[model samples]
Target chain A: MLADQVEKKAPVRRRKEARPQELTTAALSLFVEKGFAATRLDEVAARAGVSKGTLYLYFDSKEALFLAVIREGIVPIIEEGRKLLVAHADDPVRMLREYLFGWWALFGDTELGGVPKLMTSEAQNFPEVAQYYVREVILPGKALMREVLDRGVAKGVFRQTDSELVTHILMAPLLHLALWRHSFAVCCQVPDMDPNAYLESFFDLVLKGLAATPEGGK
Target chain B: MLADQVEKKAPVRRRKEARPQELTTAALSLFVEKGFAATRLDEVAARAGVSKGTLYLYFDSKEALFLAVIREGIVPIIEEGRKLLVAHADDPVRMLREYLFGWWALFGDTELGGVPKLMTSEAQNFPEVAQYYVREVILPGKALMREVLDRGVAKGVFRQTDSELVTHILMAPLLHLALWRHSFAVCCQVPDMDPNAYLESFFDLVLKGLAATPEGGK
Candidate 1:
């Protein structure tokens, strides 16, 4: 009876994640550093410590791999979801502050900064990357902000304004900052080094518009 | 004396505007409709009623010709340069109000609303175009606003602040309007279509920030 009971717990196997999956992760690390155009498959394979053929087993082509990296990398961050409304469910003013801070923190990360500009500058030509960039990154961020704005209106904190247009206005500074960071200021100084403080002024203006007790408001 | 000058000008060798210059003007009408990538040199020559060789006399390459079209075909309106600043130099609040009206009228023309976006997006990779964009287009606009802001602060109608950064914020709404007209609204409808009214809200926010009296501020 003891022998039978001991055998019953045996033969449990934890499946290892596939080698090809590991290769894809390795490819991404190389691509992000050198850029999609400059990165070579051989360099990727070498970096991954895999043969060229083994690398090809995971990604069919460099473009295909680049597309996958953006899709895999950007999607998760945007999908993490925003906490402005949920966290501050009853307070619209606090929620607006939190929302601005949320976007400011996201773009402050240089890794996050590069993706949108890199994708946008190349979007006119590469339809695939453009589609993936918008669907995964832009749409989700818009949705999160839209929810917060809707919450502000419903809470009677913000004016009964057009939520969609206000969402775009709220987004402009961040997107502008991203474009500046990745494109012109890659190794350059931001005019005012602390972007968060600058972004705060923008938030200050927008939130005041949404504020129920707007000072000397129309 | 005027009659004598006219007679002297009429008989002397008249300068011929370059054949390709003439051809480019004709080409622009077609290109605006068909787009640059789709337009052909031969079609441009045909439109100008010139031989392709004659068209080649001024602009040797397609890219050169297209650049010339962008350079010449697009320009600020005559009315745009007739700025009200000189008239209202002593009254900055009036200057700023008048200045904003100028921008509103110019941008509302519909013909010019898309030029800046098209040039920035399409020509960003080209160094010369980007330089021209930064210098001729972006800088002058900023300088004009800066002058107005400086005057406002001096007159105590506006608070003293970083005029350049303040100018950037002032233009943010214009950029937002362009985005809605061109790209952002592609995914969703633009709810607030009245840009002048939108600018009123935006300008009001800025003026409030600069206002000396804060008695009613919450």
Candidate 2:
């Protein structure tokens, strides 16, 4: 009788375990498409092939759902970046390159690309959400980048400069590229800008720019 | 009687001449504060110290008013850039530096700083506006930067890189700074970031990066 009961509940438990990821994935696409205020909970449920009741069980509110999406989808990518920083400890130059390219491959090139545009569009209206993103996503990401730059400088591969400022510079183009894709690229005739080529040029320009050499060496 | 009539008409003419500008300033602030779709016309008129009737006389619609704002407030700045390019014809480096700084001073540092945020937020909702901006502002700006890069390469002051890609790279940071100010800075405790210092670092980085020398000169 005990074995029979355990086997009967196993399938239900397995399906329940997968619900949050499915729900957050559904929420991300909707948030990207319709923005935060306009997207309805029912639509998210319908998109995820679940009922409104099921969504409510997983996330009490839209804000909670958004936070889960960030935690589940975005934080993992940032964690991977931290791991890469460790893995490439001795080779700061290669580490920086890999980290940037890895960001492009994992985040910028994915559906997650829409997050930057979403945050830019709605951050003012939702202060708590903005605060959460800054605290969780942006600050941590910047810290990771700062570590890379610091390592480079210490290794004598990069010039001594304000790592904080350089981190901002490194991120600006990538964020702008993502913002352009979701905003103007959606509505305007933004001539085909290949993302890979853009990243290549960015990497080439910035790496050469940051190299340690005599001032006015050229 | 003629002198009296001329005096009476002069003040009216002067105020009328300034109405469009006043109205646009009001509209720009409101649009930046509340995204485009939410801003109402009467509030704009009220903010400008004019009646809705006066607003109608100047602009037939909200869209027309936004275009006028871009035309009256922004176009002149880009035009000034063109003149600078010509004025510093023999000095590509100074021209590039001046152009970037002038952009920060004339546009990014002013009320116009909000325009980039406005466009980023509402461009998908207003395709015509985005098209007009692309045609009138972005393309021309990119053309100007490309010319500077080309001139630099010709003068052997800058490296041989794709000017098109470089122009995009050149613009991303400045645009990102403006976006940060209008979006995240409003709500978050973004430690005091000096705009002038940021631009100086950017100029230093890129100019050195673009210097034509043997690869890996460092």
Candidate 3:
């Protein structure tokens, strides 16, 4: 019964409906292989073993398909962030560490390749998609982080500054480094950098920034 | 005569050289308009007002042309940064302000609509390009800011820490903000946030990070 629900096949009783997720996964593979702009519904359908009619049943157009792919791709990255940040609830450093590791795991799928390019290239052109990516991924991730930061301030582990801005500062290095890693790792020429320790140093600097001058300390 | 040496097409240049740039720029318009894969060289040549033969005269393939466009687009951003940073040799805060503003200016350009996208997308496929972009543009900008950071540390404007990591930290927010600005501004329904003041607050936080303890305030 659990496996059946999990399978959630286009209920064999009805006109064929492609699973939104399965379509997304298939789209991911095509987008990675051919580049997003070059990918076709037929190609995605063929790869998914569905007809073009079935592919269109799920996504109205290539743009819509790409948007769904991105939304699906990043959702867990945000959701798990919410869960972890809430779970740790007391540890900003630990929360940050989990967030960094989490994003890498989510992006580790090679099929998600075109999504980054999509976010960077076509995002501006399709502001809705860009806005969606930012709203879904960035806003929630930053919000979760801000909550952790606010906790740090309450616990007096962090100095008082506008928590909102501080959150942005804390997150910037890790995300920037990750984005660069995503971009370069494909070419196999990325710097031999470790993402985990980099996050630690990054958090250390954030702590140093929020050290509150230690009363008599600078 | 001095201007002539710099401005004149160098005698060493092959006639084929300039055509590639023209082809790439033409293709960039098509890439931005129709998406990279959707664009054909014939369309690109038409956009550039050259023959199909003319397009082939310069570029061996679409991939080469696309890479050329990416290189051409980002070079100016880097060169402008170099000039701006060089001009503000003495002041780190001032240098940072100029750098952030210059970056926003580049990000706002509609000409290379797909650049950030290409950088991210292609990075997965083209690490060499990503390396070039980071080393040539990002590292140079970091080097410029480092001078100011080192000066600030020496003059008691900042505290002692590894200037390199600090430099990366100082830049993190600006870079993140730039990446998500269009989507973020609209999703959060923000008007363009003032880049200058944002840089000021960002650095103020940074300055606090670098402040020497009263005992260490040598």
Q: Which candidate ranks first by lDDT, i.e. highest?
A: 2
Which pairs of residues have clashing backbones in candidate 3?
Answer: A120-B117, A121-B117, A183-B123, A218-B213, B159-B210
lDDT of 2: 0.84
> Across residues B62-170, which tens digit of lDDT does each residue of candidate 1 receive?
7787677666654455325445567888877777777776776665335455544444334433446545555566667778889888877676666556665667766
**Per-residue lDDT tens digits of candidate 2, residues B83-171?**
86688989988988988898888889888888988887667766888888888889999999999999988988888997787899899
Span of 10 residues, lowest total lDDT, candidate 1 chain A? A184-193
DockQ, per model, reads 0.09, 0.52, 0.32
User: Would you list the clashing residue pairs of candidate 2?
Assistant: none
lDDT of 3 by residue, B31-92 (tens): 65555656778888887766788777777877777777877776776676677677876776
> Global lDDT of each model?
0.60, 0.84, 0.65
lDDT per residue for candidate 2 within A119-202, as digits (tens), equals 877778777878888988899999988988988888888898877787898899999888888778888878868888898899
In candidate 2, stretches whose alpha carbon ends up further than 4 angstroms from where it belongs are: A1-23, A38-42, A49-68, A214-218, B1-19, B50-65, B214-218
Candidate 1 lDDT tens digits, A103-186: 657543546555554454344445666666666677677777888778777766676656555566667666666555543343
DockQ of 3: 0.32
Native-to-model Cα distance after best TM-score fit, residue A177 in candidate 2, in Å = 1.4
Maximum-DockQ candidate: 2
Off by over 4 Å in 1: A1-70, A88-91, A118-136, A153-160, A184-194, A214-218, B1-56, B60-70, B73-101, B104-124, B184-212, B216-218
Model 3 chain B: lowest-lDDT 10 consecutive positions: B182-191
Cα error of candidate 1 at position A136, Å: 4.4
In angstroms, how far off is B218's CA in candidate 3?
Answer: 7.3
